[model samples]
Target chain A: MKKNEVPQDKSNLESVNFKELCYAVDENGEYTTAHSTGWDPKTIALNKAIEEIHERTENAKQRVLNNTTSPIEYYMELHKMDLPILSSYVGFWKWRVKRHFKPKVFNKLPQKTLQKYADVFDISIDKLKNIADGN
Target chain B: MEIKFTHHQSAHCENGVVSNLMKHNGFNISEPMVFGIGSGLLFCYIPFLKVNHAPAITYRSMPGSIFKRFAKRVGIKIKHEKFSNPKDAKVRLDQNLANNNPVGLQVGVYNLEYFPDEYRFHFNAHNLIVYGKENNTYLISDPVMESVTSLSEKQLEKVRFAKGAFAPKGHIYYPTNFPKELNIESAIIKGIKQTCRDMLAPVPIVGVKGIRMVAKLIRKWPKKKGTKVANHYLGQIVRMQEEIGTGGGGFRYIFAAFLQESSKILKNPKLAELSTEMTQIGDLWRDFALDLSRIYKNRSAKEDAYNNVAIQLETIADKEEVFFKALKKAI
Candidate 1:
């Protein structure tokens, strides 16, 4: 032990109550070095944390990578997954447009165009709307 | 729809239990969370599909469930290894020994394929029991189960199974406790504690900024609820003191820690500057611990706080007991 390193007694070690320590964090990161036990909880906690980090770094690499996903990463991963999007005339129209394909001027005259598209896929109007407008 | 960050709040239900948390979420948690040791569920190894958070709700188990699940554990692919690793090896060995000896369930299931007439398996689940082609032959049958003496198919048939056998063949039956589902409800409870604590854990510098957050909570809290709410909120705050294990042992811990640290500060003339902030923080926590202790003392008076807790715990324990008893009797 260093000259400045005060040897820990039972009181100092006991004072660092786990409940208060937990609450000190809960009630706004309020903490004190002293507890009944005279143990430095922050140091103890920090050391424990560092130990756990090292343990995880050594032991659970795959799990860490899997759990390390952020919201953006989650979205990106979801996008990468082969999401099934129904394809049809109207769907084709939207997909084509969304893909930056120029909409043909005479894409389809009104009459049975929408109905014909729905007929081809055997879907309802709502599903067609969902497919077409990205609902 | 995108699972927004806000929805995370709703993800846990009114009671704070989660019916199901994307399975991945389930994997993130350990079993200690839903552990109602006495009366929660019969089979410990029966993989929970919908761990309900509510105390009222029980495992959707009917009769005969224990036999099926226990049998699965007793089946095949049972591998035994001598204890070697330092971490979980002792615990595993102890559990195994207890299970193999008696009173502990250590078997697992293996290749339980469904056929028209008979089920096929490659190995016995329990190595403790020998499979000599007769009743005693229980060495191994399935990959999931291991370490067993007696507690066989014959025993299972004799034991009491739940009347509800509409469940899958692999479904566990229990005569004792119906499990409380630990889904959104538990997540909410845990989240409330963890998130609330996490929010509280920013260095609350004793001056203006620290005061501001407390004031903000006061104002925002009022806007959300009236005096009743305030009282309840205060009660919650008080409850948290206990939840975080504050009043019981926290004060002693803090005092001792501070005493040690403070002594070092006194001794270290050179590093004396380093002790100032640490000392201040330590002092505040000491004070807080005292305040929380006072609250706990008061709260206990209002009701038989521990009695209530014990009562609540008993219900859970009873179910577990019944389930295990029924399971033992059945197997």
Candidate 2:
């Protein structure tokens, strides 16, 4: 029940984290590589939730970037934001995107080290590739 | 394990109105220096059946517990069983040294394959401290025979109880003394400290030049153009606290490991040290997380499991029992 609702379902029940966003958008396990029943549920949910909320979260970011005065306006401009924070208020997605989504700038380093950080934060390798390719 | 110093000062800073109010008083006094140790700790490691009782921290004389008060702070009504204050509540609180109450307790039953007969040993208690005048003293419910010892049998007699079953449970002592376990715990601390240090790294670059370097890549959004910076800052701090909290748990794990290491290790060493640190760090982190979690979790919604500090700590002990069963396999 975020102020700015987006979408909600078992598909989006993951924590609103970077990896969660990437997973939700995953039409299939094309990017997941292999099965991992051994991972912590929170970590797993975070990865999938992030994937689901990716587009809506980005859209919401764009809206907020444009303008934000009232709560309604704030919701309209953002993708996810539970206006009045609630525990059971699960809808559209909890407006926890900003908490998990942040801009990262890494130095030119070996691919292994960079990938480790991504794994720690559960950021998608493909997204890192996109960022690297952009440069 | 090693913990990051972070300026060697953990005293909370209160500015603006809080600072102004302090000026009204004569001498400068620091508020309770709150610290977040870590979560998923094993305060009471029992290998048999146990009970997870919710630890309740209140004014003792006050109605309900801190959980209820926190609910009140957030403007929510919790239908608690209203009870009249106990006449001994004040007397007990006065005699006791700590200002807090039990958060909760845990109960669990374990099946031992070694013992064909499943002897059920249920633990029904919680750790608490009586308030101290200066920094405060720690209150440990039980002292393991083979880990560490802070209080000599003589010192145990000197301690007094104010509110709960601490006196009835027993004195604090360590039963483990193996140097290997201590060294290992210390190494783990070092590892944790290193991880925290690496995480604290500021922006890879600084200054306008660094900004330009970053901008050359991903387009930078104007600061606060879309979101409130305060929220993000708080979130980052929360995560940082979580990382360092491992140190808090490492402190206890070292103790558990020591216990596993030997009966000889626990004899004369200062077990009270471990108990004190665990109680101190546990109280600080558990206290805050309980409040914050309530807001983050239940909110104005239905009550959740272990939502308050007392209940949460109780759950920790229960989880520890889980660890104990799993850890037995290690032995």
Candidate 3:
């Protein structure tokens, strides 16, 4: 891309008002660095990925509200983590983590187990046990 | 105490850190030169490996490999350490700072407060320099940022010990020795040859073949995975290519810059011509990304949008195959 041709489209980066450094060919055909606010294609792709995460988080929240799953599932989705990643952070086996997704199993969990989940999510134990409305 | 570090923003994080650190050590290495000497360019698509719930596609070498390769090839002695606990990591970092040593650190981007929200993710391969610490804040020289920034002690600790795939584990590295003068000519030649080998590797999941494999998967995704999932997959490809500190166009432009610089250093005019060709290929990659985005946005006017983007990728693969072959012959 030419130096002057670098995309400067407004994007989600506008929230932080940051410009990304990019490389382009100057008038002399020499490579140089240019700052890009964003490009349309990248912006769209990022928005789509973020949207997917939000959709999954919302789905998990609904399941928790219906008592189909536990608050662990909701918090995991809220933090953009899948089961394997959550298990690794919480130092639990994959199957054990999956078991905790059940409200019945999660409710019977000890304070230590709840504390591990709370620590990973960087939230309080009381908050981990209860789901806040409109979070 | 500050180590008098000067930050020069670059197109990629690892290259930026290496280049900036080299300059601080009294060597003037450009970012592209650092990237090129490190043989940082590659294309790989791992179907079994998942990142962000999508198949992993990497446009560069593994996280710390660039600096490792670059240092070895350029005859620089370096030291690297990874701590299991943050307490030890903090003590070591403080010791380095007290001695006026600026060290590069591998950290996760998720909790980096200076990063924009849109760019924050669980990626743990981001590199930066910790030049000094004042009270509770660590001075940072993140190469992707326009200016130097700072992170609180707790925030820095959180990112350094971030848990997930490719966890940073409080990693720290710095160059300890350098030759009287760099062998730029041989280093550039070696870098070029390795890149050629990587691009032309025979493995189906690597190099030029890897690019082709992704093209094949793109054709099947819409029919097999449903539109929503396929669109998400396509978005993942573009994000990996353009969004993640690639210097735009999947590090192709940086490689092109490297080639251009090498042409002047090695006195090989053939490399200059190839540099232009590589830039055109980078443009092709950008076009492919734009077309893929159009399909996911439901704005593609073409009847067979998936097939069209797949064809675009195939064309890119074909050009890259021919380009690498010639590049190998040029040196």
Candidate 4:
């Protein structure tokens, strides 16, 4: 936390707007003012968060391809949601959400249910069902 | 219509918004000053109020309260509204922008496009400014961003109505009147005393004592929930400290900086000494975060790691207790 303290180099610090405190001395040397300097450690923390999201998304993606999970599983992971969170978002019971992870049940989900999931994930029903190639 | 507003990035959103809005209206104020005057600093670890499936661990007061308090203390009148209808909300916002009036809004972070992909979360207390609109996009001055940006009306609506946990509910605010001068001296003392009261409040789950409560829980987490669950919970604490709406070190550094500014304004050397003490507390908080990150990086952290983190938390709580008590008596 010095005005010029450098953050330890971390791979995830790329493209981060880490906020930090910076002090500026006045011309009279009577006082120093503190201002935000935007430092590296902030980015490192954010990067760690993003890495967690991507790691979960990747694992969920693998499950979908292996036919062990449904596309809802992939979308949930992609959006960094846990089962309880996704359930709350879609207003579904957690048990039902766990059931929706099965391809058989997920494929039979009502259009309205699909829409709810789509809205929560900020995607369209088609994309939610398809688990978009780009995702 | 365009409002000529200057945006300065700051460590926390609400403080930045207050600072920018005040400056836009001809008042030169810093974020820390706004924060301190508003009595925005507080610590609470509520176990029942879940955010993202973890207990609510907040580093500041609830959203919108700070601005309201700061405005009142400085003798400024402000207008605030929360629309139940998204359509009506958008119309009202557009009307304000068309009048060349800059407005402050609370929106969820998950859908803010300018946010880094990894940083997106369901936090609903993020503050930003909307100064104008062009075509389908609304010009934005999110204090956390390096430069002003724009968001599509569609995108804006989505985030405005973001549903889960601490929903924004289409809240918007703007200053209706401004005072020419402020009682800086009185405000500073009031800020100091209020901060002390909050930190030393008798509530077992809040203030300095709350920090200790969380420390105790941290020590127990591993024993009750196994290592993986405990590590994830610890990571959540670090996230709240370093990443979430909190400024660095859970607002410790920002509050410390506020004290430093208060010292100069009030010409009190004792407050300056206390400011340095607060900075040391911020350092301790940062060290705690570093330790948490190291545990996350190395999943095989032993029981000693959790105990060490708990001890750090206890030490921070103890220091803050003393600091706030002294701050209360100093003013």
Per-prediction DockQ scores? 0.03, 0.01, 0.76, 0.27
Name the candidate that leads on TM-score: 3
Among incorrect, acceptable, medium and high, the docking class of model 1 is incorrect
lDDT tens digits by residue: candidate 4, A12-127: 32356543333332343222334453333444445555666678789888888887899998888777667766786788899999999998898899999888888888788888
**Each model's RMSD to truth, in Å?**
26.0, 27.1, 1.2, 3.3
Clashing pairs in 4: none
Candidate 4 local lDDT, residue B243: 64
lDDT of 3 by residue, B123-216 (tens): 8899999999988799999998888999999999999998888989999999989899998889999999999999999999999999999999
What ordering of candidates by TM-score runs from best to worst? 3, 4, 2, 1
lDDT order, best first, reads 3, 4, 1, 2
Task: Give every candidate's TM-score on chain A.
Answer: 0.19, 0.22, 0.94, 0.70
Better of 1 and 2 by DockQ: 1
Tens-digit lDDT track for model 1 on B138-184?
Answer: 22221112121233343332111111112111221111222234243
Model 2 regions lying over 4 Å from their true place? A1-56, A60-135, B1-267, B295-331
The TM-score values for the models, in the order shown, are 0.20, 0.21, 0.98, 0.88
Q: Which 10 consecutive positions of candidate 1 chain B have the poorest summed lDDT?
A: B10-19
lDDT of 2 at B9: 14
Q: Which has the greatest lDDT?
A: 3
DockQ of prediction 1: 0.03
True contacts kept of 4: 0.14
Residue-wise C-alpha lDDT for candidate 4, range B1-331, written one tens digit per residue: 5678888877678988989998898888888898899898899998877654457788888788889888878888989988889999999998898888999999989889888666678777899999888887899999877689999989999888776667788999999987668777887787777878888999989999899999899888889988766766777777777763455678877787788888888888888888888877887988998887777666688988889988999999999999988888777
